[model samples]
Target: MAVTASGVFRRTAIERADQRVSWERTDQAFFSSGACHVLAWTCRDFYPDQGIALAALYLGDFEHPLHVYARWGRWVFDASGWNLESELLQANSDFEGLPVREVETIRTDLREFCEKHVHRQPHQYWADPTERARAYVARYNPPWL
Candidate 1:
């Protein structure tokens, strides 16, 4: 699904100092990549009260290290410490109402696509450290920040 600029989704506020430090560390890792290929999709939640799920994959360094992030309702789940495949399947099933088999298929397709198409360096804006920082700030700066 296309990401909208409607301002409906806002970054969750960091209430504790530890959370702030952790977020900064994660953000640093995310932006440290010389290049990254991103794949994102939005799916309807099976539980209507939970709203929608926004899922994204960040591929870098030929997939030696990949990252997955999914937002369901107000919670953001990461594949940092959990089992990646199981986490992905669970998220897809819980948020998208997709069957296990279909989620597997989607995962395979995404992997193939990344393997085939993400060989080159990222755009200049992403490649340049200064530009990347500017872009990040522009994209994520909210009133609360």
Candidate 2:
């Protein structure tokens, strides 16, 4: 199948996440393994006026969210573009038998969230996530988008 723009974004985001994790001397795929919040924040920042909210896909235990993505209405956006929520959920077998919860707001403090979940401290480069996200979106944005 032809690669979609969403696919490109997803791959590039994962590559970026991998590079971020590599700084800690590991070779794991952080984006797929645990760092989805980065993409969720990127999506939210890029579409600030779209009423986009965050959602979590629970892991084996319903209490722990294993994945986070952005949702606007019935559409979901992560590293990928806007996709139907049900379809997106169905595409990931990891979510097949799990519960999902829509987060009304990010409860944790931003820096704390990054330190705890993202495993990255605030740096001069990415201290302001909104700026970083905006730059990334602008880099990949097409006129048609």
Candidate number with greatest lDDT: 2
TM-score (all chains, Cα) for each model: 0.24, 0.54
Model 2 misplaced stretches (Cα beyond 4 Å): 1-30, 94-109, 112-145
How big is the positional error of residue 120 in model 2, measured in Å on the Cα after superposition? 4.2
> In terms of TM-score, which candidate is strongest?
2
lDDT tens per residue, model 1, 1-145:
1221111222234312233332343333433221222212211221235442444332222233332333443343331211234544454344434344321112333345446545222232223233443344344322123
**Which residue window of length 10 is worst by lDDT in model 2?**
1-10
Specify the poorest-scoring 10-residue window by lDDT in model 1. Answer: 1-10
Clashes of each: 0, 0
Q: After TM-score superposition, what is the CA distance of residue 122 in candidate 1 from its true location, in Å?
A: 4.4
Writing each residue's lDDT as its tens digit, candidate 2 over 1-118 gives 1112221223344445564433332111333333456657766767777777777664444454555667777766644445666766655533345434433445564466666554
